[model samples]
Structures are given as C-alpha cells and as structure tokens.
Target: MKYFTVALLAARGAASPPPPLPAAVALNSRKCRRSWWCRRRALGGAAGGGRMALLYRATRLKDRADTHVFTFVVTRSATREPDRDVTSKDFCCSHQRWAVAFSRTDASLGVYLVWRGACEGMRVYVDFTFTLLSRDHFTANEGFSGKQVRFSAGCAAQGRGRCITLAELTAKFADARGEFQLELTMSKVRTLYSCELRAPRLDTPPIAFAGFDWSVSASGGNKEPLTLRLVRLSGEGQRCRVRYALALGEGERRLHSGPLECVCDPEGRTPPWNPRPPSRILHKGVRLTVELVWARALAELAVSAAGRAATCYDRDKQAWALRCDTHSETVRLHMLYRDVHNVPRNHLRYVSWSAWLVRASPAPGEADADELPGAPFEHYYAQESADEGLMMETALRVEDISRAGCAFLHAGGELRVRLEWGDTYLLFQATYHVYDDLCRLHAHQMRREITALQAENYSLERQLFSYQKSLAYAQAQAGEPVGAEGTGRRSPAERSLSTDTEYA
Candidate 1:
C-alpha cells in the first residue's frame, strides 16, 4: 500500500513541472558567468579593449587536510572550441606558499603574470611545468658574465616537468640590469615575460694582499756569520714574485752565496704561503732556507690529499699542493720541490701518498764530503772525535717521519757544520713541527684516491656492459642455439669472472 501511494504521488509531481528560474538567478547559481560589466572593466573604461576577448575561471580542489590546489582555465569569448595561445606555464613554490596567484578576468581572453620571491632566495630545487598550446618556437635571453645565454624550445627549456638549481638560474641572469626579459615568438605573434631581477651581487674583488710574512729560522741558537736579503722582483706594492740572496762568512773572506728566486702571491687563486715549503739552496757546504708564512688571498683552491698530488699532477711543472674548501672561501697549501726525482708524477700513484722515505746508513767519510745533504728522513750524520773531545750537531727537517722513525724537511734536511783542524763530528735532528700535518694530508689523499677509483670502476662496468652485449651478439650469430635456460657454453672471458651473470 505504501509503495502504490508513493508511485502515484511521483507520477503527479512529474506531470506538473516547476516554473523556470530567472536569467540573473540562474547565472548567479553556476560557478562561472559572463558579465558585461566585467568586460567593460577589462577594457579600461572606454580606452577600448584589444582584439583579444578574454575570460578567466578558477576551480579549487580541496583536500581533507584543508590544503588546496587552484587550477585556472582561460578562454576567448568568441569561440568555445579550444584556446591555442598559451604555449607553456610554470610556477615556483616556497615557504609553504605558492609563488604565483591569479584573479578572474571578464574579457574573452586574458594573460597575466604572477611572481613572488627574489632569485637570491631561491632554493636549490625549483619546480616548473610547461604547457604547449601550439607548436610555435619560443626563446628567452639571459645575461651572464657579460654574455647573453639563449634558452630555446629544446632541452633545458621550460617543459611539462622540470627542476633547476637556483645558482644556475641566477648565473644566467647575473649581469642583467635590474630586470630579466623572456621572449616567446610565434609565426603570427610574440609574447613576453619580463620581471625585475632580485639576485645577489656576483662581483669578485680584484686580487689584493690581506697579509704576508717572510722570515728565517736557525738551529743550535747560534748567531751565524751569514746574511740573507730579499729583493722585490715586481714593482713596489707588488706581491707576485721575490728574489733573495745569501752571504756567508765576514770581512773580505765573506762569500756571496745563492741568489735564489721565489714566487709568492698572497692575492692569487692559491696563496703561496706556509703550505708551500721554503726554497732550499745548497751552496759551498751551506744550506739556505727561505719561506713565506701566513699569506692571505682573494681566492682559495680545492683541497687534496697527498696534498694536491691526489687530484692534480703535472709532469711538466713537477709541483704538489693541498686545498681546503669553506662556505665563503677555499684555501690551498702549495709546495714545490725543484729536483725531487723520486716523487711520482702520475696522479694515480700519489692517491694515498702512502709511501714514505727510509733512513739509509751514512756513507763513510760523509762528514768530509763537500756535497749537500740528502732527503731529511735519512739520518746520515758522521763523526770523527779529536783528543779534546769536540763535538758537532746536525738538525733535520722532513715532511714525514720515515719507517725507521726519522724526520725530513720541506723536501730535504738542513745541514750545518763546524770544522776544526784534524778531526770533527757531524750531528743532525729532524724538524718535527715543520710538517706536523703530514698524516692529515696523507689521509685526505687516500680519500681522493678512493673516490676517483670508484668513479673509474663504475665507468669500466658500463663499458663492460657494451662488451658483453657484443659478445652475446657474436655467440647468437654462431648458431650455437643459445637458450635463455641454463647449461649454455660460456666464453673464457665470461667464465673467468666468478659471478655467473649472463647478458642476453
């Protein structure tokens, strides 16, 4: 009975429909509507709207978490089929906020640019998307380091899905004069996106000295009868290179010793200072050491273990350096050994800088020889005591202690001798603190070697893939009926490798 009455009432309701709603009321209820007032406002009050009629509508997708993604649809009033004007769209986001916003427009078609956030504050990762409404080519120009960079329709261009580093983007517009312009050119028309640049300054100061020092140190605390002086090779106030001369003995017997030259630039990419060992000059049985300590520069270098040897080895120059990196600066420690034949020239051998010197036994009559001393780690002091029991001493300097626990100097040990008629003795000790950081330097070198080897290994693996593929192709051509199942014959090269992996 209840079902029959319900059906009878539903039929009566369907027979008599409700009255139609008013035009204004119906338009107001829908999500979007065309308004003459809005069109007039878009025309800028009698200035006359351009040929392009604009309309814009926004739809908001809401989630349970209360977050929203607003998608905007724009169209032309005259045609409802499809709008082919927009080629691509990209947006940035940061700090839990969308970097772009849009407002509705009443004209049949509209184009707007919404931007926020400075280029300097841009994070390392940026998100962007491109929408291709047509097949026209687009291009943009950015100024960088006094050159113009053209970003076109191909790779690195704005696309459907893309991300870029802020540093890279900032570098592109680094030299822009307060503003950046993006140009989109088509067969029939051209559109543009221009915005003021808010990137950080990218000026690097001209090289200038922050500090410098040059001094001498002596062993045995004796006042030697020698003089050392430095002459500026460059002009006054110039700090690139320097020349020095040494003199020994006094009065008319004074001997003019080595006049050596060294280059020190505290303002260069790598400051020539303490890390760079002193120059060693062996002349007339006397050794002269000259070094610059604590120099400051405008730039720094990449740090390396084996000092710089692990990463950089120049066979022609025959020099080694160490580098350190900081947020704002990179520091380099450089050392140059003029005639070191044993130091490896190939970077691979120096990866760990594991090899060190061994103390060799002193040759007979070495104290009487006129030759300068050998490497510092080698303890080779000779003695010949006289009746009066006179004694002599030799102090050494080394980069690291040898296997026998002996120390060396910058590259070689220093030598000082006091001679008397008849017999005399020679003694030497290593300069321990001169290269106290040798162990640390070696450790860094090991790390660099490991990283480089890993990269090389990966590259070899990739190459092996190609080789295996070629081998598989040859085996298939041989008509051996190679099957995907087991029990297939293997090549000797493939069999040698223990891993039973196969490439098909």
Candidate 2:
C-alpha cells in the first residue's frame, strides 16, 4: 500500500509542472535538501508551488519576537538591610535565562538585570524599564529605566544605582503583607555576534568597540611560537581587560580560555598572547576561533603629593634658584622589548607641561585663573636606544627663575605643574609658604639700608645750612651795600634751593 501511495504521488507531481525556483534557492538546492525547514517546504511545494515555499521561509526568518518581559517578587525586608542583595528565580526569555537583583546599601536601592547564560562572543543590547507593582498589582511605580545597556561576557549585569530610596520603597512599593512584584520589560533588544579566528597572520578586519577600532595581529611565524596581539588603530589612551576563549580550530575543539589584560593608547597595540614552548608552530592556514567575551576600561594611576618650596642663592650657577621639593611619588615606566616595539622611538611625550601660579579659588566674575597661560619652562625629550636601560624617569624642571619667581614668593598662591607623559598625567602642586627665616633676613637688610639713607640726608642738610650762613656773613663784611656789587646774582642758599627744585 505504501509503494502504491508513493507511485500515485509521483504520478501527480509529474502531471503538473513545478513552479520556477528563485536563483538563491536553485543555487543552494543541496543545502535546502539538508535543512529541515527546506524539506518541509519541498513537501509543501509539491502540492503548492516553489515560490510560496521561498516566501514562507523568508517571512519566518523576519518574524522572530524581539521583546520580552519578566516578572518576579521580593520582600520588603530585603530593602531595609544594608549591603543586602535579593535575587529572583531564573526566568527564560529569548532562549536566555534572566534574573533581577535588588541590592541595598544604606538607604539606596539598586536594580540590576543579570543574564545567566554563556557570554562567549555574545552581546545583547537592550532598552529596559523596571516597575514596582503594589500588592494589588494594579498600580505601577516605575523604578528606573535604561537605554542601550549592553550585556556581554565581560559585563553580565547592567542597571542603575540608587534607583529608589529605602524610604520611598517602603512607603510606595510594599503591600500590607510586605511583598511586592517587580517587572522588567526589555524592549528594542538587539543581539551582536562575534566569532574569533586565529591564523598565522590575521585576515579579519578591525572591529569597532568603545569608540575605537580594534584588530588582531600575529607575530613570530615559522619555528617560533605565535604571539597574538590586540592593536588599537585609533583613539586616545585606554586600558581594558579582555576575556577571550582560545580554541584549536573552527570546530568546537577547545584548547585554552582565559582573560587577557591590555593597555592601548592612540595608535598603540598590546601584546597579550605569548604562547609558551618556543617550538609550537602555527601553520599558515591553520585557524583557531577566539571569542572576545568581555572588555572593561581600567582607570589610570593617579598620585598626588604636597611640595615644599625654598629659595637659595646658587654659588655654582651664580644665580638665585627657586626650588620646590614636591615630595612626589616616583612613577616609573618599564619598557620591555615587546612594548618598546609598539611605541614610537622618537616622539614628544608631553602634551602640556607648564607651571601655573594661581590662587586656590578665583573670585567671582574673574576670568578663571587656572585657564590662563602658564610660564612654559624648558623641556627636552629623550630617545631610547636598544642598549639603553629599561627603566625611565620623568623629572621636569622650572628653570631660569627671574621676576616671576620673585613675585611668586611675595604673593602666595598655588603653583601647579601639570606634566603629561603619553597617555598618563601627573599633577604636581606646591602651595606657597613664605620661608619665615628668609623673609626675616631680607627685612633686616632693608631696615639697615633705610637707616643709613636717613642719616646721610640729615648730615647733608646740616652742611648746606652752615655753608649758607658763612656765605651770608662774608658777603655782609665785604659789602658796600648788600645788593650793590652784583644786582642779578643770587645768594648761596637761593642757588642751592633752585638747584634742588630743578632736580626734583
């Protein structure tokens, strides 16, 4: 009976001419035969037409649901305890299990949506809204909302801190029984997929992440073990920790999987993969899949110190030198052979390094004193050779202290020197403190000079008075009449007074 039915179906299929297949379907006929959906379509097409089968497949691919909502309940006591965390049971959505956690710290409540699934090369971009429902489940209190929150292997949870205060949660969210429902509505959800591949030389293009272009490169071919590096093509300085899974080939043949930390600046790259055993060779076309599971930017190292200011006459240089012992913590840059190749050999390292003498806080309506151009001191860049030492020191100087240094001594303010070393920056500050002993010595010297000048002025006045009196007496002794001998001539006192007035 089965053979007879099959023969009848074959006769019917031959009786009617099959509709024409699309170019895509015709070219992939072998693939269609292997696919279950295509097999169903082929059976349906025997009755209907090939065009309907293709349309049906296309429609099914585009009709996937992209939105999901998960609801859970929590107790009011969870929001009262400090540093307490309450989590919901796992709920499945979009083939992934998700859970909502409420964390309480002091009086603030934080809401986080966590993904409980594998993060290997999977990134989910979602716009989510959190709502707190009352016991009646009728009135909804919106807790918080976030847009473009990405959940990936590196970052498994995304949420807002201080979404609601403990007082607000107690007053509005809980019911008479102290239980409340929390709803997480995830919308506009998008998924990005990444696949990792390892070859002797990288053949993949750069991928965009965190506003930078990142690509992989491999070095040490032939007999040497291969080293893979993550290179940043463009962007400012950034330090990120990358989690990746290393596999043997395109198949699920796993080899090793771990996290690699890297620091990359603009036009800089990082050497994170250094395979051991120097004899391990990577063939030209042999490929291994790597997954960029997680990535996070690391904060830079910042060190601040208070400086002591001093002024001394330099006998060797024969000049007055203003010295500031900033007591700064030394920051050393260790250069390895691998890292040296990534940085430029002859390039200026500092972006802006200058000394600024400004008040701690500017008065209102005054132009920001900090923004004013500072006294640019002399600086030079040092080049490193292959034979040079691995450690480098960063010591900047404020040379040629002239009138600016003297003014700074009198007018106390903050002297800030901002030194930029590649992507890292160091801010050295020195608050001016009047050297009490030096000021006293300077004041004593000025007082002695003033006393000598006052004494000389008194003696000169006395001598002038005596000379005028003697001249008057001699003129009177030899006079026919006081003004008869020379009518236009003036007295000695008058002449001296006129000269003094003209000089003044």
Candidate 3:
C-alpha cells in the first residue's frame, strides 16, 4: 500500500520531453490557472496568448518548518518495487502557491513526494481519503474507478529518470472559480524548504511524438504542452494546494472522444474552452512509442487464461508484457502484448507494433512510378486519422499488396532508450534489423565453399588408395623377372630417376 501511494503519486507528476532551449535549461514548474491557460479566440483552431503563471520561487528551508502528512485511502501495495494501487472515494488537485523549493534547507525528495497535506491548528488531524490495508494481496477500488502507481522511483538525483501513467482516478479537487466546496483548507502553515518541482530536460533527444493527426505535431517553436505538479494540504483548520500547468513550445494535443479532463463552466452553458489541446504527450524521462501492426501474425499466439500470451513464458508469473513475433506473407509483425497491467488497463496487446504497407507494393514497372510526383501511399498503422503523425519516419519495403490489413513487412531501425536510475540518466541504442541481400549472399557463398572442399577431399582420398595398389603390384612384378621368385627390378618409368642408365 505504501508502495502504491508512492507509485501513483510519481505517475501523475511524470513529464514529457521539454522543447529545445538555447542556454542551460533549469527545472521550472508553474501554476496551472485560468489566466495562464490558453485563451479562446473566434478563429477556427487554437490561438495561443495567455497570462503566464508563477512557478515555485526558490526559498531556503527553515529549521523544522510546520508541515502535515496523511496516508492514502483504499490503496494496495505491490510486491513489485515502485508501483502501488490506491482506492479513494475522492481525490482533489488544486493550484496553491508553494514558497520553498528542493534544496539543502528543506525536506528531502523522499519526504516531499508523498500522500500528505497540512492545516493551521497546533495539532490537527483531517479525515482525508486514504487506502487501508486489509488482510492479504487483493485490493478494493472503494466504489471508485482509476488507480495508479510508479515503478523504480528512487533515482531522480543520479539521473534516474521516470515515466508513470496512472489509471484514471476521481478525487475532490478545488476549482479556479474559488468554490469553497472544492477549496481544501490549510492555514498558518509555514512554507520552507521543498524538493525543486522543476526538473531539467536532459539533452535527451526527443523521440518521435508519433501519430496525432489528430496526428498532433509539436512546433519546434510554440504550442507545446506544459504541466505543473503540486501537493495538497489539509488539516483541522488549514489547507493549501500545489499547482501544475502545461508548457508551451514543447508538446502537442490530439483528437479525443471523451469529455475534456479540465473543469467546465458552472452555468451549464458552454464551458470556457480556452484553446485546449486535442491531447498532450508525455516525453520526458521516458519516451513512449506506439507501433500499430496487423492481427493475422498475432493469431497463432497462445493467449492464456489470463489473457496473456507468449511464444515462451515464465511460470505463474505475470504475463502482462511479452515480446513476440509472427511472419506472414502480408507482413511480419512483432508485438509487445500487455495484459491488464498498465495503469489504463488497455485490453488489446499494449504497444502492438508491426510493419506493413498500405498500398500494394509498386509493380515492377510501378516501382519507378512510385517516386513519381504525388504518388499517395497507404501506411500500415492502427486506427489512425487521415494525416498519420510520426515522431520518426520509418521506411518499409512492400510485399504482396493484395493482402488484408495484416501483412508481413520488413523493417529495420535504430532504437534510442531513455532510462534513469537516481539522479543520473542512462541512454542505450539498439538497432532492430532484418536480413539484407548482402548478408544472405555472404552466407550462401560460405556454404558453397564448404561443400566444394568436402567433395575435393573425398576425391583425393580415392585417388591415393588406387595409386597405392598399383604401386605395390608394379614393385612385386619387378622383383621377379618373368619367373624369378624374389629378384627386384625397377619399372622402366621409375628406372631413369632412381638408377643410372646402362649403356649396354
């Protein structure tokens, strides 16, 4: 349960890759507020121009500053490290000013990032929502849906990076309209030292933000997503909230189907939709990539009773994530099948990636026609809008064009991974590959040389055996001239080389 609280809390604060800034980039977080939010205009799409929100200003930690803390309601701990599930009747997110930041003077990272809040009374205890442990390994959502946790949390200091996605949660949060009901109470609390809310974006190259057409595209310039993360405080007579806001010149939004997660107007009238994003991508410490592949290749897959499948598996172990592959005439697809493991609990294999061509490969003659002007192409992707978006462009060779959506394709590329431990971030490069003709040709030639060597060796042995027999017979005949039992005489061909020629 403690672990779950930690994970969930971390998951919400996760960040996407910040845009490229010129000078030394510092950790900076701002308030998520009505004014700082994008403003609405009469234009067709979004228009950016909103007031900027104040971020947590640097402050030194004073001696043992007054603080408050609380446990989560209906939360479950995981045997796994850095992950937890919490069930709370309600949870709230609010934007309140935090005076101090992470530094030697204040609370440490371990103490700062926890499920806690404070208030004014000398001694105060608030009945905020929290998850309680009952008996063994199971969990209860507490009549609510959505739970989340973070994994491998410790590192942020030594470059340990993190990315966490939480299942949707419902909490009682305050509104910008100053609604008292939504307003959590905190008073007389001294804001001293706290962990710096702002995190610097490592020179980590941004991975392709991938298909948003609602392939949403991020302008290397403006219109990027920004977010601020804060803590909530509540006690007998006092309460305060930390705020998070989205950033600009960074991330993107996508076309979505559900109601906006943001609060709406109270009048039941049209909500003030100040230039909202279709979707915002998280690309910071951990970069996420989605590869949409066809189903046929994944058919023979042995899905277990737990909805988990793998060509090979670990015993009684969770099979939520498995790397498997299938080669079909249409396209060979490799999948990272996931069970109900991820925070969102998506059913279909999580991150199913396969390579395929949308149109039949250009015919032999059409091959030249392909590079022709404006030759449109159908791309192999999961349910994507018309203009497919990709952070990185991948090139694939076409196989049979007449096949269904699921077809075998050949694709190879380089993978850059972002991993963090403590305060340090580690990057790894893995190159995905498919056999090329040159490699195959070299292999074939090696096989041919081996075969030729074997045959020549066999022939040489046979010739040596026959020659030995003939030489023995000739020597025996020479030993007896026409009838002598033991006299030896050299053969005419051998005589000149070993013995002097007789004149007579």
Candidate 4:
C-alpha cells in the first residue's frame, strides 16, 4: 500500500498542469466583466494610432521539462497615423517601428510563431497587415508567413522563419501597437533568461537609387505610371524602411504609405500607384523628383552580405557594370562610338536602341542589327544576371525622319559618324571622307571661276589699247587736214596747186 502511494505521487508530478495566466491578464479578467473588449483596447489600431502599450512578453510553458522559457523582444518600432504626419509621434508607423522577436532555447521543434509589423521602403497610404505563428504547418494561415521582422534572435540559417496570420491569433495576444507585458511566475526548476531589446542602428543606412520613374515621355516629359521596387542586393538579414518625397522648389511634398520591409530577399516592392502624377511633377520649373531614404541598420546588413571586395559599380575593358548582388549574372552593354555621350546623357531625337544577348562576343566589325535578338523591347532590363553570362550589344538606329546624322559608340574602340541622306537612303560612313570630298569640290569650282575671270580681263585690256590707238590716229589726221588735196575746200586745193607751182 505504501509503494502504491509513492507511485501515485510520482504520476501526479509527471502530469503537466495548465500554465497559469499572466498577472496583468489575471487583473484585467477580474477588473473587467468584458475581457474581450478590455483586450481589444490594449491592442490599439489606426484610430488609436496603433500605439503599442508593451514591447516584450514572456510566459512559462506547460511542458516545462521538454521546452525552455520563451522570450519576446521588440527589435524595431512603427505606428500608423493614416492622414497625419508620420513624425507627429502620435504614430511612428506600425510598419517601420514595430517588430517583435521570439526567442527560445530549442527553436528547432514545433510551435512556430508568426509576428508582423510595419516594413520600410513602402508608402504608408497602402494597406498592409501581419500575423503570428502556430504549431500547425499544413493548414493555411497556420504556418510561416513571408512577413518577417529583423533584429530577432533565431536560427537564421533556416532561411525563412515560420509565421501565422493575425486572424488566427486571439485578440488578447496580437496587436499592432508597440506594447508588451510579460508575467513571471517563480519556479525553482526553471532558470531565468533575460530578453535583450536592441535599438536599430540609424547612422549609416542602405543605399537606394534616387528613385527612377518608368516611361518618362521624351516629348512632353510626362510619366506613364509609378511603380516603386527595390532589391536587397548585398544586405542579407538587413532591415530597411524606404520613404519617398517629391521635391517642390520651395519645400518638399511627401506621400506617406506603408513602409516597405526588406528581408534580404530579391523581391521587395512598394505598392503600385498610378494616380495622375501631381501637375507640378512635370512642370519644368518644379524640378520634382522622387527621393528614397532608409535606415542605417539595413545598410550594415547589406555591407556584411556583400563581403569586403564586392562593389556596387565597376568598370573593365569589356563593359561598365552596375552591381546589385541580388541579380543572378553579370552582363556587358557595349557602346559603339568613343565620342558618344555617356549614359544619363540626353539621347538624340528619334534615336532608337536595340539590344541583344549573345552567347559569344561579336568579332570586331561583325555587328549586324538583323541578326540581333528578336523583340529588343523585351531586353530592356534594370538589372542583369551575375555570371560571366552574356554580352549585350545595342543596335542603334534613327528613324521617323528623311535624313539623319548621328554618332554612337560601337563594339570596336573608335569614333564613328553615320549619315543617312536623300530619299534613296545613301549612307555616308566616315565624316573625314565626306568633308574631304566637299573641300575638293569647292576648290574645283573656285579654280574654274578664277580661270574665266582672268580670260575676260585680258580681252578688256586689248580692246582698251585699240580704242586709244584709233583716237591718236584720228587726232593726227585732223592736224594734217588743212593741206590735204581731198579736203572739202576746193579753193584750198587750187591754192595748194598754185602754191606748188610757185614753189617749183
């Protein structure tokens, strides 16, 4: 009978009891008749600015012998103000500022947790929400969701962590407001573990391109649509929050949306918005451009992921390259002429560029447009792959007009000028030869005019001399006219004859 009693006590101790309720939760249950409403109030929303009353929580597990104590920490913070300024402190953006970290001694087992918060690099106006994780992996919204908070302690090598949707978690436990309360129950068997709260580093942030606009019309400077996207590039496990503003001359105009949260995956993107761009966006005087900003914590992660030798931009004999490690390969886009303007230069009117990906670099002087990759429009890419992968060549042409003269870089290293003229499409390849021919023709025409002018001058000189001699002879004849026998005066002739007879 005594042995039986000992076995009964051992069995009672072995059977795990339900974990006790947290202290604040216990007080709330007693103070408020409507526990659900009280819990909802604690978890604030956009109407309340999604302010978090607590930042961390801890609870003992029922299976105490098998699992360690679980600790939750707030690594980042954010709040949503909806129509007000994000900086108003009333709401710091739940997406940018709110991130919860769940840590335990043995994370390999079940009990996957999913927590969501504001993400950087996205606008605040867009709709975004996150949820927590649960043990069930097969059910929808039960396992891991892609939304991850940075600066958490876990086995990051597992790559994507498990998560659950907000709808699945009880309202008492899930909240967007950055608030927390952990209840501690004294236990001799369980060891006390402290949770660390880390403030994200803000000094050096990830570098994002000054935002690029798609389909900027060349004619009226109009933009077609606004699609914002970014890649993690070199930052693995980096946390980034991106925001943009339009630069109006006097002051900046900001459009706030849900911040984009980055997880070093290549697929981070901002919500798409196609609203007619602000009238002032294209105004010549506004100088409006989209500006991108991020947090320093993200920058540090990207640097660590890229290693010491990696560079964002590099150049070599084959091509000038822009590197974003998120891409899969390296490519070469060879310019044709040495004198052609560098990238970012204004392309000439009506100039068209056709690009191709070739397995092998074309031989010197072997480039031809007809053999280029089909559907050149599809080849326009923002980023290239990350291998010694492909050589991209651009076939440049100018059309929509009768004639054109332009210069572009070629695969070979030389300055080239192409001239297309006349209805028949005569092409002149070399500028020097064309200019030389023009000079020769001009010289020939000048020589012919010189010869003709010299001959006319000689004829005029001969005619002037003859006219002068005739005048002199006529004057001499007039001087000798008084003694002439053929004179009109017959008496003079008779007088001359009498004079002659007297003289004889």
Judged by lDDT, which candidate is best? 2
Q: Write the per-residue lDDT of candidate 3 for residues 158-277, one digit (tens) a residue.
A: 100111111211121111221101101222232111111122431212111101000111222123443222111112121111111222222353221223222112221112222244
TM-score, one value per model: 0.14, 0.28, 0.15, 0.19
* Sliding window of 10 residues with minimal summed lDDT for model 4: 418-427
- RMSD (Cα, Å) for all candidates, in order, is 31.0, 35.1, 32.0, 38.4
A best-first ranking of the candidates according to their TM-score comes to 2, 4, 3, 1
Give the total clashing residue pairs for model 1.
25
* Residue runs of model 2 more than 4 Å from their true location after superposition: 1-65, 134-140, 200-504
Q: Candidate 1: worst 10 consecutive residues by lDDT?
A: 418-427
Question: Each prediction's Cα lDDT score?
Answer: 0.26, 0.43, 0.22, 0.26
lDDT, candidate 1, residue 127? Answer: 24
TM-score-better candidate, 1 vs 3: 3
Q: lDDT tens digits, residues 64-156, model 2? A: 434555444455535543322245544444434566654445666666676666345657767777776543223234666778777776555
Candidate 1 lDDT tens digits, 1-504: 232343345334332222211223111222222232233234332122111221111112223322222222222211221211121123211111122211221222112222222122111112222121211111223211101222211111111111122243334421232111221111111111111211121111111111222333222212223223332222324333333344333365444434444444433222212211232222323322222211211111232213222222322223333222112222122232322343322111111111111223345744322211221111111121211211111222222222243322113332111111111111111223212233344456667777887777656766776687686788889966544327676644455354663332
lDDT of 4 by residue, 1-504 (tens): 232343345434332322211223211132321232233224422123211122222222335332112222221121111121010111112112222222111111111111122122222211122222212221222222222222121211111222222233323332343221221121222111111111221112233231211111111223433332333344333333344332222334533333333322333433343333433234333322233432222221011112122122111112222211212232123222221223222111111223322212344786522323432211111122322322333343222111232222233322121111101101111123222333355456667777777677556655765665566578777884433346555542234335343320
Q: How many residue pairs clash in each candidate?
A: 25, 2, 81, 61
